[model samples]
Target: MPFRPDPSLPVPPAGADPLPLQGLTLLLVDDSRFTCDALRLILHRAGARLRRAESLEIARLHLNCYRPDLAIIDLGLPDGRGEDLIAELSQMGFAVLGISGDPAGRDPALDAGAAAFLEKPLGSVAGLVRLIRQLTTGIGPVAKGEEVPVPAGDPMALRDDLARAARLILAPGDPAYARGFVQSLARASGDASLEAAVRDSGTPFDRARVARMIEDRLNRLRALA
Candidate 1:
């Protein structure tokens, strides 16, 4: 008779198999540590390995040595616009996906040769899993009927988001450089008041408004902390 199975080995939970992304690897490019944390958990559950880079410069460094199967880039990186990086990655043959809170940024991301665009606050784990499968493997999403976990909203992360935006606001020159990042930061952090405050921060003569916004938001963030 054939060798029988071992009776005491461990087993994965139900619906854990059929992982469509079994051999795929992904890179997440975003400045928000919290956003990365959330996405990391989602991708892991989907059976895909994740690599992270917080800025364009760092992402370039990662690209020099390792190539992921897919790259999901956030438009608002600290060093540069992710659209610019997408062009280079597209040229290198990576299946690239772009994500942003600003609709305007989405078009530029696509123009730079991203495979597709995903709106921010990615929200649900099931939606993300399905999206990656559809974008990378051209296969229907697996585990459609299974339970999908939700990512937690981290207050500390939200505070960091405000801190980063405050730095950009205080620095002179053009706030436009960080406008997209700040807006996305507010949205993901669930701070609607701060979002409205940064609305015109990129325009000249709005320094007072921006400054006031930052101060107010900082107070709230500190309390949350």
Candidate 2:
């Protein structure tokens, strides 16, 4: 199918570089609003027009209306697995990048016909840009003028991550869920100690210890003026 662009989507900034992905449109299909926001920040700064759909149905709607140059799909969607969508988009000839928090999902994503598989929570925006450059144009940096200087730490995203940690700590339902959140949050916060604590936290006692650790860290972050 020939690519189509949505008129309602905002174009890249006027002064932005027109190389790399300057004229391309990207669709991100993921359930997490926070993650979609992060992708928007990264891709928009890198010169691509961004559109987001939070579920598989919403993504289908976007596909029916407008065809994007590329789509980044999250495997564990609320409604359905992203692998299915990747197969469909692949059949339709769009370059699809499959992303997942679970490491085991990578093979299935590639088997479903994704051009590449990425693990999340991503290390940095620069990694994302580099992946795009590698995927689209073989080998090169982000094409000079298209580079966006990513900060060492984004206070807002970190704050949201902390809030999530607090909630997970407070209402511990599934151990796997809590453990997964701890891993992702730890990565986002760049807290190696916490990451090790959570990774080693397998037994009930360990989980309780991690919960206290999370609570303490959250409290410290909250108390900061």
Candidate 3:
């Protein structure tokens, strides 16, 4: 029997048929710990095994040892654009899926050879399961009657992302990269105020202001913790 995921189990118990993605293996390339945590929960519930890479360098290292059935890459990374890695993975015969907060990234990601593109705030577990099935087998989505459960948001993971973004903002290197990282995280986590702040923060003075905002956000996350 195929294995389906049971969210209550840390790892699903053996001997029962699970969801459609039971035997599938996936690689996720993203820098946000919160994003990773969210995807991990979703994939876990679908009985898919997932491995994560936080940067291009780490992803390359993972690729050296093994190739997964699908590679889900975030458009932005701490090291470089995920488009480059997606193109390379596609050339290597891997089914590549690109994800990003910006809808504008969809065409570029597809042009880079991704088999499909998913926009972020990846909250829908059932939608994800159906999409994986379609991408891998050319089969249509599962029946609409199935009850799909959404994963609960991890506040601690969100806090970690906020803290990391704050640190990057205050750091001395690549101001553009820092700003972009914050913007990406803000959009991915559905923080419109933060996203707007980071988007408008082009100058050094503006970035400083955004940095302060990030710090404040981080503090708020901590208070809730």
Best by TM-score: 3
lDDT (tens digit, per residue) of candidate 1 on 104-143: 7778999999988977666566667777888888887766
Which parts of model 1 are misplaced by more than 4 Å? 1-20, 146-150, 202-205
Descending-TM-score candidate ranking: 3, 1, 2
- Candidate 1 C-alpha error for residue 45, in Å: 2.3
Stretches of candidate 2 exceeding 4 Å from the true structure: 1-19, 31-38, 54-65, 78-80, 101-104, 121-127, 133-153, 169-178, 200-205
List TM-score per model, in order.
0.81, 0.66, 0.87
Worst 10 residues of 3 by lDDT: 9-18
* Total backbone collisions, model 3: 6
Q: TM-score of predicted model 2?
A: 0.66
- Tens digits of per-residue lDDT for model 3, 55-169: 9999999888887888999988888999999999999889998998777889999999999998876645667777887887677876543344445457888888888887887
Itemize residue pairs with steric clashes in candidate 1: none
Off by over 4 Å in 3: 1-18, 146-152
Error of 1 at 174 (Å): 3.8
What's the lDDT for all of these models?
A: 0.73, 0.70, 0.79
